[model samples]
Target chain A: MKLSIDRQIYSDACISKVVYWLSAQYAIERTLDGTIETLSISRNDGHPFDETELRSQCLRLLNDYKLRQTIDDETRDIRTILYAKAFADDENLTVE
Target chain B: MKYYLLPFKFTRIGDHEVFVNEVGDMLHAPIGTAEQIVNRTIEDPELYKSLVANFFISEIRIPALLDVYAERLAEKKRFLDDYTALHIFVLTLRCNQNCIYCQASSRDEHCAASSMSRENMRLAVQHMFKSRSQYLTMEFQGGEPSLEHDLFLYGIELAEEINQTEHRHLTYVLCTNSINLTDEVMATCKQYNVLISTSLDGPSWLHNQNRGKQDSYEKVVKGITKAREILGADRVSALMTASELSLNYPIEIVDEYHKLGFTSIFLRALNPYGKATDNADWEAYTNRFIEFYKQAFEHIIELNKQGHVMIEEYAAIILRKLLTPWCTGFVDLQSPAGIVNSVLIYNYDGYMYASDESRMLAEENDFTFQIGKLSESYENLVYSPKVKEWSKVWNNEAIAGCSDCALQAYCGADPVRNHSTQGDLYGFRPTSLFCKKNKAIIEYIISCVIDRYDELMPIFRNWIR
Candidate 1:
């Protein structure tokens, strides 16, 4: 199956995340054409999957990865702080 | 109404979105429920109440129970609270059988130099007592630990002598191929009340084929029976590793165990180590193992329905996380990755490794997980700079892909696996076979609970009990 995803909407990193999970099921090859990212997917052994369901699942996973990316982006500083508070020594330091 | 969202993730299981919170509290809400919660537009009063009760959403701007939630999360990770409770002493690399997928890379029985010396065994026993853990499990492993009957006996005797005054609760386990389990080994096991943990691949032909011996299955079965006769049926147990050929015979494997009168089966996957790395394709094997696990689990459930008490241990471990607040002592599924925290390996070379897999890696000439030397103090071994490094990426919550996973609460972090397979301590999740296998199995287990709750719950409860 060949599908072109809007690179503006889904970053290469996000697309890679989705592809990583699907790599076990599908042999995925990615290429960049200007602003459009093309994904060529084929089953490792069996016949090709249904294009509609495959695309839908891919987009769903892409959305999830993007959401997680957003969460990770937003919470990066807080997570560092939390870890520092939980594990690192900070007895002499004051929280501003 | 204003609301607060706790740390959680959701995935579409069947038609509904199942949400899981940080502490493993879960709720199956309808599609678009996540968006509604995000937008603060969940209008259904009952759904809202369920969300709040299940720790998905809190109505208070700043929840008063945040401290309590932190405490509960700490409780869920209580395995980290205990010191290394399981100390494995790999007595030797000498064995009788040449199993095809032998992870230990065992040498022949005549190779006396491959076995642990009495001095190392004594030092290892003293090291075992150094841990402040009230409960300690001293497990014996080997090429075949039973081959070095003298070392095994001496190790146990030293531990028993120390426990006379130190008096920490002690449990002894012998992990053997059972082929070398002679009358002497059985008598020693009976004396110390040592539990015999043997490997049984499947029925006769499959078992023998995997072990590279025609009568290996017979020897193992005979060993199991003999051990049970002396140690009591409940004390002796067996575990199976799904080799490439074993994948094609899940039901047969379950039947073999049932025929042997064993109540539980741990359908463990093959690690990519030692001679077992001969497995051609792990991705294909993992998928097949998932199917094999589901089929065998269903068969076990059917047997339970027929009034036979049987359990699939992997399911039981995941189910404990899903159905109860208590955590399992299983090392593989732990966040700190069960290395050093829950289990440590004292190899014949006098080096203490993080886990059994660590020692196996050492056999392949990789010492990535050798934490310390047995000659060192337990304090230095447990609190080494290397162990401090492992603590960094050992939590799933702290990992990149695993952090956002809905099953993170049920799953764990394995730095050793990641380091071995992916060439790093922090694993790449998207390409992780560990993540793929655990996710598929855990999701399948939850699907069973969700799709066939009434029919399976009684059986699941029976197994856990």
Candidate 2:
């Protein structure tokens, strides 16, 4: 099965996470050309494949991870400050 | 209006999107609520305030109460400050009953060679005091700890003698099968105020079948009765391990515990260790155990509704994580993983292991988890090179699949279980039965809270209380 994901809509990190999860049951190969990333997936045990289900799962995971990426990007600094304030002895963190 | 996003993770449960923060506070919103929150389009006044109040968002760039948020986050991980409180002493590997699935790899009662030597016992006691924890729990386990009565008694006496100068609040627990809870054992327990934690699988036929002994149930029941009479009912508690056969009888198992007058039941599943490693299909068993847990939990809820108070201990631990700001002492459900952070095992083989399951792995000649021998320094044993390797995979916040998981705060990391089941310390979460079982059950509990909040919250509140 070949999945062509638009890079503008989904990210490499998001698509990579989906592939990592499916790596247990499937052998997935990825290649990027221009803005489109193609995922070539095959079953690990040579069993029958569910193309529609697999595609839908990839899309859903991609959406979820993209949202997670947004959250991480927004909160990374604050999270660092939270941990420093919580554990660091010097408590040198300051938020503007 | 406009608000800045705080750190939170979300997953779909039932028809609602459940959002959990770093401190494990859960907020159930509509399906598109997360996208709305991220896009800064939340219009519901109540939902917006809830998101702000619950630490999911901030109206300002930095909330005024960030210190409070930091404190709550620290409080959830306060178990790290306590060091290793629960120290397990594997007194002997000799057991009376022949269990079909013995996780401890217990030998027959006649196997005195498997017992801990007196020199090792004294050294283990000395090592226990080396921990700086103000509170220490000295738990004795064995094929049957009562088989080594003299060693058990000596361990407690030595702890008490040292505690006079050490000034630590000490608790002693005896993990036994209760078949051989003799008068002498009861006297020793009474003298030391030691708590009895015994096993009762279920009813007679089921318990006897799982135990591989015909009269096992009767003897255990009689032992429980005697222990309660001599050592107060509150001091005697029981735990039930869900065997392959026991999974078919969840309601029967819960009812049996209630019938035996137990206030709480820890419906634990079989780990991949010792004789239990013989299980043919762990993935199927994990799925079945999740179903069994739900069935038994529903039955427990029904019992509580009938004005009978019964607590499912596993749910209570998860509930404490979700509902309270403080962390639980449960070793299996912690971030740094429980092995050495919360527990340590002084095995009968004169070597220190990371956890009880670590010692069980040692019985199978897999000493990947062995810390060091009893003769070594406490620092050397705890901070060994093997422990350093384990520490790499111990934190769930850093693991691959678990790092981004919405349920990471409610779940834990187990490098030992991963190594045992998957042949590596850094386990693949997609195929991990431990991961599957915990996620399914934690999601089921959250679904219950969403679907039947009013009906189950009071009962859950009482259980956590």
Candidate 3:
């Protein structure tokens, strides 16, 4: 339960995930304690994606890298596992 | 199928997820092990990812997530019940100068008869006031708004009269050359509380060359200084254009504004219409113009760093996109198109142009924006099938680059500009020089302000707010 990885790995994962949700133009700023303090982008262009899930996935991706460090896990396999179910349920949306 | 992962944190309570803002910031929430949710998600793999891809990026709008998701971006944008047009009333196309790249300049004096008559001007004003939108702006444009001082005065008084009599809320402005800012004109403007805009195409030589037959440089500097003296600094500002000769002296343009004490400069790209198309060849590759913009803007930002307090017009517009979640009310950036959304252009000849650019195109016999006429009822002009079709086409925000760009939400691409310049509602080459020029400015501002930025956040927020 005390699963962890180096701050460097976590940092890389965090960067990758933020870059995932945002282009290089955005990121989640962190406090000295390494806790996320803000989420921001580089431009005012409109965003239509879910901010909550985007953040959640970004964190999840970081944890996945951490999990790989602690367990006998495949990073590629975990990424696949995380995204596999996205297609079929992608359409279950409500229009305004 | 949910499997626990490590090292990541999520805003969660037990197993439930939390929403984030446009910037990824979340309100205070109890932290739960993202590991647990990942494990739980892993157990029922398809269910979790499906919900996610749907909620996060899919084209469909998921109902259960609607209120929550909409709230996340509500800070950046709002759901508007109605769209408005940006009315740019071209009071007179009879410009004093025969500049090579004057987009609205007359190709010949043939258009001298095209000045908006007093009757049409009154009708246009009446219709604009009677319109349903609470917010409005009436822009006086011309060979110089001051040149037609009486008609310009009549237009402003009419607008103010309607403002008090009909209880209409509107802002009055004029785009003019500094050459004609007589004391009488200034008094009329002050009485009306009008915002006046002018141009300074750089130092004397450059300014004189394009402005025609007169001492343009001295004229603009003096006029602007006088207008500022009388109108107060807040009401007067200027725009710059980069023509062929201008490409060689971009910094001089910036310097000219600084010497005159302007805090903002609009480095407007030339719209290739009207007199400009004939002179487009006067400038070389647009890439050169990009170099001009890039250098001028980057230097201006450096000046801002040194506390000179200058802004590149294009950059400020782009910075608003990079820094906020909403669109600046710039007419050029509107979708459903700002063309007919807020303002309709009534040409001097009594025809309605969808946008000012459309009027320029009219020089080539193209009348895409001639939606109606002052001779006709204004109500019928706005609600007509032509207006609807144009608005519909304008509103269908579906350019590939725009839809996919990270900054799409921050921008309102001007289809009218694109339609006039590139001849398409959605230009496939948005990544081309024109688009890159816009994008680079955003890139530069973001590069400059970001978290290392402490002072500009207020202005940045104001831009989008």
lDDT of each: 0.84, 0.92, 0.60
Model 1 pairs in collision: none
Minimum summed lDDT over a 10-residue window in model 3 chain A is located at A79-88
Q: What is the interface RMSD, in angstroms, for predicted model 2?
A: 0.7
lDDT of 3 at B230: 90
Name the top DockQ candidate.
2
> Which 10-residue window in model 3 chain B sums to the lowest lDDT?
B21-30
lDDT of 3 at B289: 73
Worst 10 residues of 1 chain B by lDDT: B61-70
Model 2 agreement with the true structure over B121-203: per-residue lDDT tens digits:
99999999998889999999998999889999999999999999999999999999998898889999999999999999999
The alpha-carbon interface RMSD of model 1 comes to 3.5
Top model by lDDT, which number?
2
lDDT by residue for model 1 over B1-465, one digit each (tens)? 887665578887887788887678778767877767766788799989988887666776444555456556666777777778899999999988888888888898898689898999998999888878889999999888998899999999999999999989999999987777788999999999998898999999999999888888888888888888888999888999999899999999999999899999999988988898888998899999888888888888888899987889999999888887777888889886899889988999989999888999998889999987788888898899999998999988778788678898899999989988899999888779999999999988888888888999888887777
Hey, what RMSD does candidate 2 come out at?
1.2
Interface RMSD, every prediction, one decimal place: 3.5, 0.7, 12.3
Q: Where in model 3 is the C-alpha error above 4 Å?
A: A1-96, B1-85, B107-112, B279-284, B430-434, B447-465
Cα displacement (angstroms), candidate 2, residue B365, comes to 0.6
Docking category for candidate 2?
A: high
lDDT of 3 by residue, B338-375 (tens): 67665677677777777777777777787766777677
